[model samples]
Target: MTVTTDTARLPLLLTTLLLPTVARLWPAIGATADAEGWPAAKTLATLLEHEVAERASRRIQRHLIEARLPSGKTLDTFDFAAVPMVSRARIAALAEGDSWLAKGTNILCFGPPGVGKTHLSSALGHALIDAGYRVLFTRTTDLVQHLQTARQELKLASAIEKLDKYHLLVLDDLSYVQKSQAETSVLFELISARYERRSLFITANQPFGAWDSVFPDPAMTVAAIDRLVHHAIILEMNTDSYRRKSAQARAVTSDPGTTAHPN
Candidate 1:
């Protein structure tokens, strides 16, 4: 078959317009359309649809990479049965919707270590990313240190402003941040800057009563807690550690002589 000059030039024009997916796929789509005796409008619509779907997929992949969520931590992988206090339905609703995020609502998970706070937070991050929302997951101590450096360099406001791009910021292990003026000051600044503007999801091992250990000053502690819980969904996961339960189950399974009793 002889190729027409206009048909050959179409791909180059599409590519120049930054429609790479459409450019690459139009040839096959055009062939199918021609075989089916479809109208020109239908062929163009089909090509555009393929390009839109491909762009959406690429956007999600980029968001997932930028999220930095822990691998294998997703809603499906989280054991909801282990933490009965936390409602799976509520978590699912939060994951599937963006209304709360639009309102700049926060999510605070308080519990002892190994009770799935981090897992749940990371899972929510993964779900939100899939739902086309940008999320960034980082340790509280690490982000605080970065912000402190920015403060010292007189770029703290700019540094915090850059984080405004993400719809949700997941701060894991909030209890691990050192109780120092420098550290707590930057953290408080971040909370204040994002207050009622961008959402924050925090996982902490301590309750609000004990947050004095993290903030140092009583006034600072109260102010930070006030801002966080002002429009927040508090998740109390005071259940037994999942790690301990898994270890116990593994021990029982490994010992052939041990008989496991039904709970």
Candidate 2:
């Protein structure tokens, strides 16, 4: 009788339209009300609010995994004071979706390996992701190979088109792409296709002047540099290698008890 009464109280259209999770909330709501002396309606509201938050958290987790971002690197964990030259204000502004993103500005991180370039790039991608943007992270070699295979399979255009869905693409370790015309062409095509339409976050181990050995043709190298730098924010990670420091610290901390005197 109570069930029938409750069913009758809900409009037919509304009952049909109700989400499964919302419908499932009734039992939990009733338990909460009985245990805590909350009004059933208030309990329902609280539970539903929690359900929305949990679902959003799960969605964020899934997006992060799908993004293929390198692990353990976020703005919170980054040692920003260690690299004071990277303008925190500028990066924070960029992460907040300022005019640069909408206007297709790129981010180029130029530094030697092990200097936290990848860490900063991945951390920035996470910030953009938190702001509800779609981002993809891939190594330059892996992405180039994938695109080359797409070209061989005669689906290069469609492949490039599919990549357009992502708001930003983080191409890590750009210096590792072998110095061959085919690889360079594939990579150039990708850069050209996204020009002024989407943003790129590129990490390289060399400065722009040193990129000629990587690109097969001088003209292509010049063109690529021009396009990438037109509206770019260059973050020069000119710091000592954190990896080397960490290793040295560990070695010092674990020194053997016997120190040899001049023998």
Candidate 3:
């Protein structure tokens, strides 16, 4: 097929205007427009729709990369059957993030180790990111250490403020943070800063009553708990450890001499 003069110039004109998608797809779009006898407005609308979709796709990809969530931890992969107490419908609704995140509502997950708190939190982070909300996932101790370093350099406030861009911050293993004034002070400041402003999704092995070990100071512990629980959704997962159960199942499966009896 011979290229028309106007068609040959269209790609250059579109590229000059910084519309890369339109420039790239103009040939196919032109072919479709001619075959379908589309009006000028329809052809232009088709080009714009593709451009908008391409930009949205690129933005989502960038947000996912910055989120830093763990791999293979999505809502589909989570075993809701194992954790009967947590409602699958509730989780799916929360993942949409329209009601809670917009109101700066926090999510607190309390449980013993290996009960899938980390898994659930990371899964939510992944979902929230896919839903077009910016998210950040970090271990409590690691983030505290970074904040401590920032404080030492007199940049703590700036560092904390930088995190405001994230709609949801996922802090995994809050109990692992050391109980020291330096560590706890910075952690408290972070919680205080984000209180009623941005959302936090936290997974902690310790309950509120035992948080003195985390904050060291009684007043700070109470204050932190007050802010977190004020407008929060609390999920208590007190079941047996998933890892322990998996280990036991593997052991039983490996023992060939074990026989199955009729019920």
Candidate 4:
């Protein structure tokens, strides 16, 4: 069955196979590419542009959805009206590119749990990612544990280097547990190495005064906080727990078909 010399349709066949690669942007320039006959150079250029746009869109979605905020709320969805009136200058300062955000300035977010601390930091992280900055989100406990494990494997410096690649790093739940002596020392090293190289966003339930209890060593704790707070915008979230309202809303609207647990 070695039939047919339809060289006329060879280019059209190629375009059909490549159209699916730009499926998201179909019917615009993609549809033009799929039409019969050898495609003009402009059509190929359009396909390339479509592919680039699709890739960027996918990356943006990954950055937004993979953002690890357990509260299931986002900055846009949160009630900023309840947000405290801080200095307008501080808010504006975040928009600027300084050695801190560029070189990775350490940012410390401290307040009680459920006061939108994580939300704000995560939002800032999201914005940074959108602005073409590499960002990573992790819980402080998990980060410290990873560092400990890396030390056991004698790869701590390499692990820290991996983390340092991100332009912005967000660590949530800083008050969950106090760092061990070794963990604290490793954390100090991370703070020093990234002192002005990369920016860090940390959400903590404890205030700066009680931070010594977490680090335990007065001098190192002060140094860590000092590096973190330099040129940082401290947003003290003093609002009541929005989680309570969300929980109450869920309780009132719970499924009628579900039975309550019996004692």
Candidate 5:
């Protein structure tokens, strides 16, 4: 339908002039308004909302790509039943809206190897990315080495400043870092710099006492723990290895070379 009258053409003209960037939407907006008999106000509102959502989706995709998050993990795919002690409700809230990271609250996940710590952390991070939060994932040793290199070049502060851009920094397998002053010093500096400004989501195979093996010096170890636990959420993953359990189930379900078990 043609807008022959000046009264009807005024709103459409204004919409195009105001949203020149989304001029492609003008045709659909006019078509929708004509077909649905919608008021200009309603049509403009709907098209504007659609434009905002599309832009948000594009931004989220970019964040995910840059995040380098562990793939193929989400709350839906996690076997919460296997780990009964974990608080599913709490995790869901944090992933969706807790915004604990916004207040510089750290998250510490402690458990033996294969207990799904990485999986849980990665899944939560994926959720946060979808929720418009920036996340960066790195292994404990790699990030420490990177920091140490930055220190060598006298660019440690600059490196840390770059990292501060992310809302949450996920360090996987903190127990693997060797007890070396060079490594620990840089790591400590990172923690100290972001102490009350950014968040850390860390996974460790060892408990707090065992962390001394990673830090060596008792004072530095204590300081690291203090900063981490202050205003933090501690998740103790005490369950057995999910990978082991899955392997055991597969063995039981598999055939044993045509041999039948006696009933």
Candidate 6:
């Protein structure tokens, strides 16, 4: 159907009037009310959409964790906003090839127990997953125990290989339990295999100097430390215990149904 210029402009006028509906139909396109706002908003919105898509893609990456740790948790449940220093920029940087995740480097979150070291490490694992990296989370004790079992079944090498497959491996509670000679050997072998080929995220109550105690063999300790710390980011998180603080807060705020004792 052929229409005059004036009549054609009428439909354009209708579309302009119905721009809100148009915007709703294509939210990704980011149509704004103001003519000047639409261009800039569209560009910014496109970038934001790409960023969210990349994040969502990483979130779907497969991850597994040993369940023995009482508070074992995934990055999915982590509260990134609650962590003051964990910015998206840091997460993004780590996701890049030059960072720990890409370089197969180790990330050590060393501090006292009950702090958010595990949480922060798990959150980074989650962020790396969002960036399309495979991650595994496990307590050091649980992992050693599993490897011990794997050794009995003559699958120790297989288990270690499985761990190496992950782009990033998270070993939480590294110093919580003492290691057996066999467990330490197995762990050292695992770390050695992944050296320069994958990344590790470890949370330990003990400092680097104290880690030697975990590895009884002096030579093995040196070797493990060399591989683990060659390209490492040590996040010395010194925050107060979240669990203790929360418990204190709960004690201060008595439950309405419970009877309170006299102070």
For lDDT, the strongest prediction is 1
How well does candidate 4 match the true structure in TM-score terms?
Answer: 0.72
> What's the number of clashes in each of the models?
0, 0, 0, 8, 0, 4
lDDT of 4 at 219: 92
State the lDDT of candidate 3 residue by residue for 239-258, as single tens digits: 99988999989989899689
lDDT score of model 5?
0.85
Q: Which one wins by lDDT: 1 or 6?
A: 1
Candidate 6 has a TM-score of 0.65
| Candidates in descending TM-score order | 1, 3, 5, 2, 4, 6
Writing each residue's lDDT as its tens digit, candidate 5 over 15-120 gives 6666543555767777879998999898878878877887788889999998898889778788899888888998988886345777899999999998899999
Model 2, global lDDT: 0.82
* Candidate 3, residue 207: lDDT: 83
Better of 4 and 6 by lDDT: 4
- Checking candidate 1 for backbone clashes, the offending pairs are none
lDDT of 4 by residue, 177-207 (tens): 5855355567777777787777778888888
Q: Which model is ahead, 2 or 6, in terms of lDDT?
A: 2
lDDT of each: 0.91, 0.82, 0.90, 0.69, 0.85, 0.68
| TM per prediction | 0.94, 0.83, 0.92, 0.72, 0.86, 0.65
Return the TM-score for candidate 1, rounded to 2 decimals.
0.94
* C-alpha root-mean-square deviation, each candidate: 3.4, 4.0, 3.7, 7.2, 4.4, 9.6
Q: Model 4: clashing residue pairs?
A: 100-105, 103-197, 103-198, 104-197, 104-198, 104-199, 105-198, 105-199
Give the per-residue lDDT digits (tens) of candidate 1, residues 115-187.
9999999999999988989999999988988998998899999999999999999999998887864657789
- Model 4: which ten-residue window has the lowest total lDDT? 69-78
lDDT score at residue 119, model 2, on the 0-100 scale: 86
User: Model 6, stretches more than 4 Å misplaced?
Assistant: 1-89, 95-99, 180-182, 255-263
